[model samples]
Target: MTGAEAVGSGNLVMGRCVIAGKSACVLYDSKATHSFVSESYVQRLGLPVCELQCDLVVSTPASGLELEVILGMDWLSANRILIVCCEKSLLFPNSEEPELLSSHDVMKELQNGAQCFLIFTHLVVEGEGMICVIPVVQEFEDVK
Candidate 1:
């Protein structure tokens, strides 16, 4: 399922993902209404983490000059997306991919008319769970 469907259905995405040779599934709960990652996950992913329960950052898109976004964990979680009436697909750029972006970067891309697929995520940080909007890269990939 797409991130929107998962969030609307009030479900969590749990499955095994092989990261750095460790078998771990990304367990994402959209109902939490907040997004966060375990310190371990953050460390493993090598993404900058904030100590505050909730935080926002504004970043410029690498591909554009006039966009910025309030990036949070929810915005960072998706992996792929389908747009254009599901006839077209887009991959969520990893840091190495040069297309993966922070919230601000995404906003810039949107403002510039570089459209493919998009999802908005809002994260509420509490307990030990994290909520995120996921992009569907493969048709059969599981979101819950």
Candidate 2:
């Protein structure tokens, strides 16, 4: 069902995707630049893996996982399947309409000006270049 029909449910996009002749539930997350597959899922494919040195790094969980296939930026770029989605249904962007930026993209204009590092963040600037910087850290040693 589309988002219009499924409102109360979270903003997760669920769809059936055919990969290697297998249909699987594909969750679209714009924030996630990379894709991943569980070991159990790939194991079902029964494809022999080639032994190659890969610098691809994934954050280690508390417990080590024996198997996981991650589709990184390289994979996404190579497979040019554009996912156009909004609050409603997902589709491909037409010639007339342009695709909006993904959640991972920088949407707003950020101020690059250097603000003096003070005790805390969000310091209010006073009139005419006046700032009172305070030390957040204190230097004191406790003897046991």
Candidate 3:
């Protein structure tokens, strides 16, 4: 199946939310089991974005010591939830493979402080790929 089809199947299976605005289309991949936002759409938003195939496996903190994560529109949709608390760590259950993680984990991590230095190591690309970094908060009050 194609990427879009896989996304559709994943949504059907997981019952995740879909966020499609005039500028973007995002969905959760229940099968490949990763959240994704259309690269093309994100580009239109005037942000420098890059994508490596799921199999490509490009990661930050090549040392495997620093916490790493992949974030995009689809991830935001299912995880639009938020938790306002102090002291927490982000759990990446899907970090190993292609499984959806609980939004609760996202909320806790964001609230507790996830600002750590990141170094992306990509075999195919020259040097480490460091994109723009932005701090995010998942407020439960705004997830309608």
Candidate 4:
């Protein structure tokens, strides 16, 4: 499934997961044929990429998406993971002790970041004078 379709679908589940020891928002999309990670995210995290034997193209909306990763059916079935949509959770049957990953509205967590970027972009586009962004975390002051 396309990212746009997944975002609009009721079957899609949003949750948090750790990737390379960093927190990341993930979308569990049952309709997607294969799992995918954002190219920009991969570059930022310095994750290795393996070229596919055949070409694969993905089409997504031009804007309004901030997805970092998408876990599709291929990964779910291979990992023996079950999606309990009614309860909004994922069950991992392969684990020594069954593990559950509860789903949450990751959008709520990302709203601040999205808003910040959107405002910054708008100001830049409208030439609304010099803009300064002071991040709460000093370490991330240079992030943008």
**Runs off by more than 4 Å, candidate 3:** 2-23, 50-144
lDDT digits (tens) for residues 1-144 of candidate 4: 655665686555778889887677787878788888888879879988888899878754314567788888899899888899897789766447633322333355465452211222343435666667755554645546
Judge candidate 2 at residue 43 and give its lDDT. 75
Give per-model TM-scores.
0.25, 0.37, 0.24, 0.54
Put down candidate 3 lDDT per residue, 6-98, tens digits, no spaces: 444432222222234342222222233454444454555555776556665432211321112234335534665322223221233333554
Candidates sorted by lDDT, best first = 4, 2, 1, 3
- Candidate 4 TM-score, C-alpha based: 0.54
Better of 3 and 4 by lDDT: 4
Per-residue accuracy of model 2 over 30-75 as CA lDDT, tens digit each: 4456776766667777766664486776442213323234444444
Each prediction's Cα lDDT score? 0.46, 0.50, 0.39, 0.70
lDDT of candidate 1 at residue 89, scale 0 to 100: 24
Worst 10 residues of 4 by lDDT: 114-123
Clashes of 1: 13
Error of 2 at 85 (Å): 2.7
- Model 2: how far is 55 from its true place, Å? 10
**Candidate 3, number of clashes:** 1
Off by over 4 Å in 4: 1-10, 50-53, 60-63, 97-144
> What tens-digit string does per-residue lDDT give for candidate 1 at 1-144?
544554355333344446656555354333333444445655766767546686666221112211111223454345332122233222345456445578798788889998646554764679878766767666665669
Q: Global lDDT for candidate 2?
A: 0.50
Residue 85 lDDT, candidate 3, scale 0-100: 22
